[model samples]
Every structure is written in structure tokens, then in C-alpha cells.
Target chain A: MKVSAIITLKKDVLDPQGKVIHQALDGMGFENINEVRQGKYFEIDVNENDPSKAKAIVEDMCKKLLANLVIENFKIIGTQ
Target chain B: MKSSVITFPGSNCDRDMDVALKKFGFNNKMVWHDDNELPKSDLVVLPGGFSYGDYLRCGSMASKSRIMQSVIDFAKSGGLIMGICNGFQILVETGLVPGVLLRNKYLEFICKNVFVKLDNKENAYFKNINKDILEFHIAHNEGNYFCTKDQLKEIEDNNQIAIYYCNSEGKIQDQYNPNGSIKNIAGIFNKKKNVLGMMPHPERMIDQSLSGEDGSIFFKNLINNIK
Candidate 1:
């Protein structure tokens, strides 16, 4: 089974990289953007046959290593 | 005093720390990151460097290395463990300490000497220390520390803050903060106070001709405390 997850900075956490990118976009004439936030995406293929079980394993991975709970939140997008 | 410095794959400051430890009367040993057993020692150090190439996050991968279990055990047993620079990052990743090191606010690497004021000296790392402020070398891109409000309150309640960025005269002001760390924290200690994590590299400031001698005051005090 394959699972996908996205890790994003918490709402209150500062995203300096996103801010820099937003500034660059503004300079390139892509104005009207209210905000920009940076995140990470990961796809993992587990040996488990069940989709739910695979997603659960990936979620565990997210909680342990993929994302830092202090500043990041992880979401499981889907399992295939 | 006996000391060990764990050298991760990309740890550039391991040798420097070893030299500093030996200079201060510590019989230091270099321990590889893959080694499972930590030699008997009075102090253990995780030196500053770009460990594991900072691939996933600063100190994230190195925190999960094979040798960490022993390190954790040693810390759990109340042995002194100090993490400087990237080592501080690893300490947070391992949950041995509170908070995380975020990217620099200006998105630039900061490499220079900065003064740090001791916040609490009750811990083993700084008990009865000679100086209130020390000039130390700080070189890191992601040394800006952050934490949740609840954690901050708890850490404050426990007096876990170790040091703060300050001026040469020991003034704790925002203008002295090199990075946007919460509360201008430059170093912190675990609840037990046996484990310490700090962004500044004391080893880089040990020699007078090379940099400064404040690190000597720190190490000399630390060894005496343990003895």
C-alpha cells in the first residue's frame, strides 16, 4: 500500500522561507497574494496490504520523524 | 575527568571539542556515531557540525542514529551530556530537551562571536560558575529557538533556561539577540538539568590567542562541579 502525507507549519509558527518566496512572487508581478506558507509532502509504500494500516504506519512515521510537533502538523492525504 | 565526544558523519567540530576537553584536564575519547556503548566518562559532548548533511532537518537524522540509545541511557542515568550547535538541534529532536531550532529570521547563516548571559546556575553545567556572562562563538543557520506557549511556561516555572543572548556588559535586551529565539534563549537544560543544549560553541572560544578565554572559565567550572 502507498500513503501520502503533507507536513505544514502550524498556523502560528513563522515561515521565513514562505515569506521570501511570497516577496519574490510579488516582485514578479504576481500581486494580490494574501499569504504564503511552506510545507513538505511525502509518499511512502509500505509492505502492508491494507490501505488503512499503511496509512496508520505512515502517520506514526509522521508523528515520530516526518514532522516536528513543536512547529509542524501532518495530514494524511490518502492511501492507495 | 573523563569525557567522550560523539562524532557524527558530518561533525566538523568533534576534534575541536576533544582538544578543548583535553586542554581542560579531561581525558577525552572520540566515540563514533555507530558505536552502541559509551565509554565510562564524567562528561559526554555532541559537538557542533552539519550532521548527516542536515538532509531532513538540522540534527533530525543524527538524532535517530544507532548510538543515540546509549546516549539517552547515559543521560537518563544522570550523566552529564552537553550538545552544542547542531548537537542542540539533535537534543530537541530526541525530546531530551524542549523546543525546536527554526530557521534564522532573516534567512541567512550567522557566524560570529556573541556574548551570552547565564540565566540559571543551579544546574550541574553551571553551578557556582565564575562569570555571569561569557563571550562564545555561535555559527548556525537554524539556531533560532521556538516552542509552544505551554512548554515555555513550564520551562520557565522549572528554571530550565540556561543562557540568553546579551551584550558584553550582561544586558539582556532584544538588540543583543543575534537570532529571533524565543525569550532570547541561547541555551537550555533538561528538566533534570543533567542534559544541556546550546547554540553557542564553547569549544570555539577556549583559547585566548585563537578566539577568547571565556570557554575556559566555563569548562573549568564544569569539571570542578562534577568532581
Candidate 2:
């Protein structure tokens, strides 16, 4: 099974890279942008045959390694 | 005294740390990350470097290296452990130390000599040190320390803050904060005070001619404290 997850910084944590990207976009004539926050995406292929099992495995990886729970949140977006 | 310095694949400062420890009279052993056991020692150091090529996150991959389990055990046993720069990042990733080092506020790599004030001197790493403020070298891209409000409160309540970025006069202010770390925190210790994680590299400042002697002072005092 294949599972995808997104890891984002907590709301209160500063995202300077995202802010810089937003500024760059603004300089490029983009408008109506409220804010920008950068995040990480991971695609994992688990050995499990079931989607739920794959998601659970990825969730475990997120908690243990992929996402630093202190500053980041992880969401398993898809399992196939 | 005996000391061990763990060398992860991408660790560049392991040799420097070994040199510094040896110069200070420690029988320093270089331990590989793949090793399953730590050497008998009074001190264990995670030296600064771009471990695992800074993949996924700085220090994230290295934190899971085999030797870390032994390092964690050593810390749990109240043995002294110190992590410098990337080593500090590894400590946070291992959850042996609280909080995380975020990307620099300006998203630029910082490399320079900055002053740091010892916040608490009751621990083996800093106890009986002669100076309250010392100039140390800091070079990292992700040294901006951050923690949740609750964790901050707990760290403060326990006096876990070990040092703060400050000026030569020991004035701690936002202006002197090099990396935008909260409260200008430059270093921290675990509740037991045996585990220390800091962004500054004392090994870089060990020699007066090459750099400065503040690190020499630190090493000399550290070995004595251990004894």
C-alpha cells in the first residue's frame, strides 16, 4: 500500500521560508494572499496489503520520525 | 577522565571534539554511529556536523542511528552528555532534550563568534566555571530554538535553561540574539542536568591562537567537575 502524509508547522510556530516565498510571490504581482506556511510531504510504500494498515504504519512513522510533534503536525492524506 | 565522541556518517566535528577532549586530558574514544554500545566514560559528546546530510531534517536521521540508544541509556543513568550544534539538534530529535531548533529567522546560515551567558551553573557542564559570560562560535542554519508554551513554562520552572545569547557585558536582550531563539536561549539541560544541548561549538574556541581560550577554560573546568 502507498500512503501519503503532509507535515506542517504548528500555527504558532514561525515559518520564515514560507514568509519569504509569500514575499517573492507578492513581488511577482500575485495578490490577495493572506499568508503562507511551508510544509513537508512524504509518500511511503508500506508492505501492508490493506489501506488502513498502511495508513497506520505511516502514522506511526510520522509520530516517531517524520513529524516532530512539538512543532509540527502530520496528516495522513491518502492511502492506496 | 574517559570520554567518548560519537561519529555519525556526516559528522564533521567529531575529530575536533576528540582533539579538544584529548588536549584536556580525557582519554577520548571515537565511537561509530553503528556501534551498539557506548564506551565507559565520564562524558559523552555528540559533536557538531551535518549528520545524514541534513536529510528530512537536520539531525533527524542521525538521532535514530544505532549508538543513540546507548547514548540515551547513558543519559538515563545520570552520566554527563553534551551535544553541540548539530549534536544539539540530535538531542532534541531523540527527545532527550526538550524543544526543537527551527530554521533561522532570516533563513540564512549563521557563522560567527557570539557571546553566551551561562544561565545555570549547578550542573556538571558549567558548575564552578570561572566566567559567567563567554564568547563561543556558532555556525548553523537551524539553531533557532522553539518550544510550546507549556514546555517553556516547564523548562523555566525546572531551571533547565543552561545558557543565553548575550553581549560581552552579559546583557541578554533581543538585539544580541543571533538566531532569534526564544528568550535568547542558546542552550538547555535536561531536568536531571546530566544531558546538555547547545548550538555553540566550544571545540572551535579551544585554542587561544587559532581562535579563543574560552573553550580551553570550559574544557579544563569540565574535566575537573567530572573528577
Candidate 3:
């Protein structure tokens, strides 16, 4: 099974890196850019076929390693 | 007392902390960041430096190192842990210590010896140190300590405010609040008071009139309390 995890800063948290990128894009004359929010994507290969088990494992990984629950949020998607 | 200083790739103050601990008759060792096992020591010191090149936010990468798991485990078992400057950032990143360290509001690297008034003398780390002004050096860009209003109040009410930046008169001046740290807090302790993380470099001020010796008392008091 293949799983993809997308992690992003929580809505209320400040994203300094994203802001810097937004500024750079503006400097480059890309006027259409309104805001830029940065996120991390991870692709994982899990041997388990059960969607519930896979979701549980991904959630554990996010809680323990992939995301900082204090300031970030994460979502996991997989082929059921 | 037995102490070990964890050295990351970019840590420049490991030797200084080792020397300070040795001067206080401590059996000190330098543990590498990649090592998962901690030395059999009473205390663990994460000294300051640009760990992981200060990339991905200060201390963010270093917190994910292999050694942090063991450090976190040791801390959970009630062992003493102290993180200074970059180390403090690492502590926050690892979630071993509460709160976050943001970039200096002025966005400039601050390097100077500043006065910190000891707000809590009951901890082992501050026992011998007077509940008054002590000078220590701080050099970092991401040293501003921040927390939510309610969390700040909870920390203050719990006596976790270990040290506060102050002026020559030992008063916390609003304008002189270096780094825009909330409550002018320079250091804080975990709920159990066993873990301490501060931005000031106590190891740099161990020698009086030389390195500005007021900081040495921190080590002395910690060792004495452990014994």
C-alpha cells in the first residue's frame, strides 16, 4: 500500500518560511501570488492492506515524528 | 557529580561546558549527537552553537537527531537536563521543554553579557546562587521566548520562571527586554523542575572577573544539590 502524508503549520501558527517565499515571488514580479503556505509531503510504502491499520500507523508516525502537534497539523491519504 | 555534554556537529560550546563541569569536580564526558545512549551521569548539558547550521529553524533539525530519544527518555525518568542558547532552542523543538523560541524581534544576532535575576532559588540549579542579579553571556538570533498568555500565567504561577533579563538596577526594563522574551524571561523549568533550559551561556561565565564568574555558581549549586 502507498500512503501520502501532508503536513502543514496549523492555521493560527506563523509560517516564516512561507512568508519569505511569498516575498521572493513578489520580488520576481509574479503579481498573482496572494499568499504562500509551506507544507511537507511524505510518501510511504506500507505493507498493510487494511485502510484502518494503515491510517493508524500513519497517524502514529505523524504524532511521533512527522508533525509537531503543538504548532502543526497533518493529514494522511491512501489508496483504500 | 557525573555530567555529560551532548555535542552536535555545530555545537561550539561543548568544551566550555565540559571545562566548567570539570572545574567543579564533576566527572564530565562529551557525548556525540548520533549516539543513542547517554553516559551514566547525573546531569546532561546541551551546550550552545549553531547545531544543524541553524537550518530549518534553529534547533529544529537537531531535535530529530538519534540522541534526542535517549535524552527525552532520561529526562522522563527525572534526570536533570539543561539547555543553553541554541540548546534551549533544541529543547523546545524536542518538546522536552515548553514554549517556543522565535527570532529576535529586532532580527539581529545579540551577543553580550546581560544581567539575569534569579526568580526561583528553590531549584537545585539555583540553590547557592542568590535570588538576585547574575551576569551571563547570550549570543543568538532566535532567543526570543514566547508562549500564550494563559500558558505564561500558568508558568509564572507554577514558579517555572527561573531567570529574567534585567538592567543594572536589577529591574526588568520594558525597553531593554532583550529579544522580546515574554515577561523578560531568560530561563524556564519544566513542570517537575528537573529540566531547565535557558538562553544565557552560564558555561561562558565560570571565571570571576575573567569570564564574568557569576555564572559559575549555577554549576556549583547544581552539583552541590545533586550530592
Candidate 4:
């Protein structure tokens, strides 16, 4: 089974990289932007055949290593 | 005094820390990140470097290295452990310290000397230090510090702030903050004051002619504190 997860900075945390990207986009003439936030995506293939088990395993990984709870949040987006 | 400096893969400042420790009359050992056991020592250091190439966040990969278990145990047992720069990032990852280091506000890798004003002097690291302000070198892209409002309250209540970026005259202002750290926090300690995590590189300032002697004073005072 394979699972995908995305990590994003928490709402209250500042994202300077995202801000810079927004600035670059603005400079390129993409004007109507309220905000731009960046995040990370990861796909992991587990040995488990059950999709639910694989998702759980990846969720544990997210809690432990994939995301820092202090400033970032992680979500298991999909399992296949 | 006896000390140990852990050398994670890509840790560039481990040797410099070793030299600084030994120069200040400490019998320092170089410990590998993969090693499961730590040699007996009075102090342990997590030096600065691009551990694991700063993938998935600075110090995140290195914090999970095999040796960190031992380092965490040491810290829990009230042993003195200091994390400098990337080490500070690792320390926060281990939950031994509070707060997180984020990308610099300007989105740039800052490398320069800045003055840091000591906050609390009741701890072993700065208890007997003569000066309140010292110049140290900071070099990193993700050195800005952040924490939840509740964590900030707890940290302040416990007096865990170690140092603040400041002017030479010891004035801590937003303009003096080098990396946009929260309240200009350059370093902090655990509630017990044994574990210290700071973004500045004291080892880089150990020599007067080459750099400055503030690091030398820091090491000298640290050794005496341990002894």
C-alpha cells in the first residue's frame, strides 16, 4: 500500500519562504493574491497490504518524524 | 573537566568545539552520531553543521540519529548538554528544549558576528561569567526562533531564556536581532537549566587574534562551572 502526506506550517507560524514566493509571483504580474503558503508532500510505500494499516503507519510517521508538532501540522492525504 | 562532542554526518563545527573544549583544559572526546553509547563526560556538545543537508527541516534528521537516545538520557539524568547552532535545532527536536527554529525573516543565510546579552545567570553555564554581553558568530538560514504563546509564557515563567541578541552596550532591541528570533532569543535552557540550545557559534570566537576571545571566556567559565 502507498500513502501520501502533506506537511504545512501552522496557521500562527510565520512562513517567510512562502511570503517570498508570493512576492516573486506578484513581480511576475500575477496580481490577485491574498496569500501564499508553502508546504511539503511525501509519498511512502509500505509493505502492508491493507490500505487502512498503511495509512495508520504513515500517520505515525508523520507524528514522529515527518512533521514537527511545534510549528507544523501533517495530514495523511490518501492511501492506495 | 571531561567533555564529549557528537559529530553527526556533515557536522562542520565538531572539531572546532573539540579544540575549544581542550584548549580550556577539558579532556574532550569525539563521539559519532551512530554510536549507541556515550563515553563518560562532564559535558556534551551538539555542534553546528548542515546535518543530513537540512532535509525536512534543519536538525530534524540528525535528531533521530541513534546517539540522540543517549544524549536525551543524559539530559534527563541532569547531565550538562549544550547544543550550538544546528545542535540547537536538534535539541528542540528532541523536546529537551522549548520552541522551534524557523526560516530567517529575510529568507537569507546570515553569517556574521553579533553581541548576545546573557539573560539568567543562575544556571551553570553563566553563573560565574564576568560579563553580561559577549560577541558570538551566527551562521544559518533557519535560525529564527518561534514558539506557541503558551510555551512562551511557561518559558518566561521558568526563566528558561538563555541569551538575547543585543547591541554591544547590552540593549536588546528589534534592530539588533540578527535572525528575527522571537524577542531576539539567541539561546535558551531547559527548565532544569542543564541543557542549553543556542544559535550562536561560541567555538568560532575562541581566539582573540583570529576572531575574538568571548568564546574562550565562555569555555573557561563553563569548565570551572562543571568542576
Candidate 5:
């Protein structure tokens, strides 16, 4: 099974990189950009074939490595 | 005292910290990030550098190193831990310290000797140190510390605010709050008060005439109290 984890900073936290990107977009004459936030996406290939087990494993991985629970959130998506 | 300083691949301040510890009569060892076990240490110091090249974010990658697992365990066992500069960022990334470090408000790297006021005297790291202004060097781009308003309140109420940026006159003014850190916090102690992380480098200022030497009191206090 292949899983994807989308990790983003928690809503309440400030995203300086995102803010810089937003300013850059404005400088390029791009409009309609209400807000800009940055995140990371990780794709992992798991050996398990069961959907439930894969989900659990990926969630564990997110908590352990992919996401910092103190300041970030992560969601897992996959097909088994 | 038995102490060890963890050195990531890019760590440049490990020697400075080691020298400071040795000057304070500590038998210090340098533990690499790849090692799974920390030296039997009463105090563990994480020296500053661009760990893992600050990949993904400052201190983000280094927090996942093999050594941090042991550091976390050591911290859980009530061992004293101190992170300076990049070390501070790693502490937050590893969740050993609370809050996050964002880029400097000016969007540029800052390196200079700044005044820091010792706020918490009860901590072992600050024991016997009078509440006064100490000069230390800070060199980093991502050093702005942030947390929620309620979290700040809790930290204040718990007496975890360890250090604050101050001026030559020893006044903690909003303008002197380097990097726009919330509550002007320059350093903080964990809930247990055994772990401490700060942006200023005490190791860089151990000699009074050279680096103002006032910073030596921090190490002297640690050596005297941690035993």
C-alpha cells in the first residue's frame, strides 16, 4: 500500500514562510490570493496490504516522524 | 560533574560548549547525532549549528536523529538539558521544549552580543545568579519564539520564563526584545525545570573582558547546583 501524508502547521501558529510566499505572489501581480499557507507532503510505500493496518501504520509514522504534534497537524490518505 | 554535548553533523559550537563545561570542572564528552545512547550525563548540552542544514525547517530534521531518542529518554528521567541557538530550535522540534522559532522579523540573519535578564532564579541553571543583565551572543535567522496567548500565560504562571532580552541599562523594553519573541522571552525552562533552551550562547561569553564573562555565572550555577 502507498500512503500520502499532508502535514501543515497548526492554524493558530504563525507561518513565516507562507507569509513570504504570499508577499512574493502579490509582487508578481497575482490577485485573488486570500491567504497562503505552506505544508509538506510525504508519500510512503508500506508492505502491508490491509487498508486498516496501513492506515494505522501511516498514522503512527506521521505522529512519530512526519508531524510535530506540538505545532503541526497531519492527515493520511491511501488505497490498499 | 559528568556532562556531554550532542554534536550534529554541522554543529560548530560543540567545542565552545565543551570548553565552557571543562572550565567549570565538568568532564565533558561529545556525543554524535548518530549514536543511540547518550553518555551517562547529569547534564546534556545541545550546541548550536545549522543541523541537517536546517532542512525542512530549522531543527526539524535533527530532531529525528537517533541521538534525540536517547536525549528524550534522558530528559524523561529528569536529566538536565540545555539547548542554545540552533539547539533551541531542535528542542522545540523534538517537543522537549515548548513553542516554535520563526524567522527574524527583519528577514535577515542577526549576530551580536545582546543583554539577557535572568528571570527565574530557582532553576538549577540559574542558581546563585543574581537577577541581572548578562551579555551573550546570538547568531541566527530563525530565532523568533512564538506560542499561544494562553500558553504564554501558563508559562508565566509556572515561572518557566527563564531569560528575557534587555538593554545595556538592564531594562526589558519592547524594542530590546530581539526577534520579536513573545513576552520578550530569551530562554525558557521546561515544566519540570530541568530542561532549558535559549537563543543566546553562554559558551561564547565565558571570559569577562572577551565576552563580558557575566555568562560564566550560568555555567558556575549549573555546576554548583546540578550535583
Candidate 6:
């Protein structure tokens, strides 16, 4: 099973990288850009056959290692 | 007194800390991150550096290294543990201390000396220190401290805040906050005051010719406090 997780900074947390990226986008003449929030995406291949089990395992990983609850949030997209 | 400094693969400041500790009359040992057992000591330090290359998140990977379990255990047993610079990132990641260090507010890696005001004098780290303000060196990209509101309240209530970024006059204002830390916090102690984590590197300031003597004062006071 392939599990995917996405991590993003919390709303109130300051994302400096995101801010700089937004600035670069603005300089490139891309208009109508409200904001740019950079995040992390990961795809993990697990031996489990059940998608739900794989997702649960990956969610645990997020809680412990992949995501720091103080500043980042992690969501597991449906396993493939 | 005896002290141990843990050196991770990317820990560049471990030797400096070893030097500082030894200079202040401590029997200091260099402990590798892969070692399971920590040598008995009065103090253990997680020194500054780009540990684990700051991958995934700063200090995230190093927090789970082989030797960290012993470090955590030592801290739980009320042994003194101090983390400086990148070590501070690892401390927070280990949950030995509260809050996390984010990137600098301006998206820059800051490297400079800044004065810090002592918040509480009751702890072993700062007790009996003559100066209320000391100049220390700071170098890090992710030193902007952040925490939930409830955690902040708890931290404040417990007098866990150890130091604040300040000017020479010890005025803690927005202008002196180099990395946008909350309440200008430069260092904080755990609830029990046995564990300390901070962005400033006192080891870097141990010598007047090299940098400053504030760190010498800090280390001397620390070892005396332990004794």
C-alpha cells in the first residue's frame, strides 16, 4: 500500500519560506496571488494490504515524527 | 564537577562546549550520539550545530537518535541538561521543554551577539550570578520560538522563562529580538528547572579575546551551583 501525507504550518505560525516564495511569485508578474504557504508532502510504501491500516500507521508516524503538533499539521490523503 | 557533551554527526559546537566546560574546572567527556549509555556526570549538554543536517525539521531527526533515550531518561531523573542553539531545537523536539523554534521572521540565518536578561535567579543555571544581563552569541535560522497560547500561559505561570533578548541596558524590546521569539524569549527552563533550552550559545562567549567573557561567568557559576 502507498500512503501519502501532507504537512502544513499552522495558521497562526509564521511561514517565512512561504512569504519569500510569495514575493518571488509576485516578481514574476503572477497577479491575483493572495498568499503562498509552503508545505511538505510524502509518499510511503507500506507492506500492508488494507488501505485503512496503512493510513492509520502513517497517521501515527505523523503524530510522532512527520508532524510537530506545535507548529505543523498533517493529513493523510487516501492510500493508493 | 563532571560534565558530558553529546556530539551528533553534524554538531559543530560540541568541541567548543567541551572546551568551555573544561576551562571552567569540569571533567568533561565527549559522548557520541550513537552511544547508548551516558557517562555519569553532573551536567549533560546538547551543543549547537546543524544536527542531522536540519532535515525534515530542525532537530527532528536528532531528537530520535540512539543516545537521546538516555538523555531523556537522565533529564526525567532530574539530572541537569542544557541545550544551546541547535541543541535547543532538539530539546523542544524531545518535549523536555515546551514550544518549537521556527525560522527567523525575516527568513534569514542570524549570526551575531545579543544581550540577554535573566528572568529568574532561583534556578541552578542563573542563581548567584552577579550580572542580570549577559552578552551571548546566537547563530541559527530556525530560532523563532512558538507555542500554543495555553502552553505559553503555563510556562509564564511557572516562571519557566529563563532569559529574554535584550539590549546592553537589559531592556527587552522588539528591536532586540533577533529571531522573533515570543515575549523576546532567548532561553527557557523546563517546569522543574532541571532542563534548559535556548537559542544563545554561552560556550561561544567564554573567551574575551575570541568573543566575550559572559559565557565564562555562566559556566563558572553553573559548576559552582552544581557543587
* The best candidate in terms of DockQ: 2
Question: Could you tally the backbone clashes for each prediction?
Answer: 0, 0, 0, 0, 1, 0
Candidate 4 per-residue lDDT, tens place, A3-26, comes to 999999999999988999999999
TM-score of chain A of each: 0.96, 0.97, 0.87, 0.96, 0.92, 0.97
lDDT tens readout by residue for model 1, B1-227: 89999999999999999998998899999999999999999999999999999988899999999989999999999999999999999999999999999998889899999999998988888888988999999999999999999999999999999999999999988898888999999999999999999999999888889899999999998988988
- Residues A1-80 of candidate 1 have per-residue lDDT tens digits of 88999999999899999999999999999999999999999999899998878988999999999999999999999988
TM value for model 5: 0.90
What is the CAPRI rating of model 2's predicted complex?
high
DockQ of all candidates, in order? 0.93, 0.96, 0.18, 0.95, 0.38, 0.94
Task: Kindly list the per-residue Cα lDDT of model 5 for residues A34-58, writing each as its tens digit.
Answer: 8899999988889988888888999
Look at candidate 1 and tell me the lDDT of residue A8.
Answer: 97
Off by over 4 Å in 3: A1-62, A74-80
Docking class of 3: incorrect
User: Candidates 1 and 2: which is better by TM-score?
Assistant: 2
Q: In model 1, which runs have C-alpha deviations exceeding 4 angstroms?
A: none
Worst 10 residues of 1 chain B by lDDT: B121-130
lDDT of 2 by residue, B80-179 (tens): 9999999999999999999999999889999999999998999899989999999999999999999999999999999999999999999999999998
Clashing pairs in 2: none
Query: What range of 10 consecutive residues in model 6 chain A has the weakest lDDT sum?
Result: A71-80
Give the local distance difference test score of model 1: 0.94
**lDDT tens digits by residue: candidate 5, B36-79:** 89989989999999988888778988898999999999999888
Q: Scored by CA lDDT, what does every candidate get?
A: 0.94, 0.95, 0.85, 0.95, 0.87, 0.94
Scored by TM against the true chain B, the candidates give 0.98, 0.99, 0.96, 0.99, 0.96, 0.99
Q: In model 4, how large is the Cα lDDT of residue B195?
A: 99
Q: What is the lDDT of residue B142 in candidate 2?
A: 99
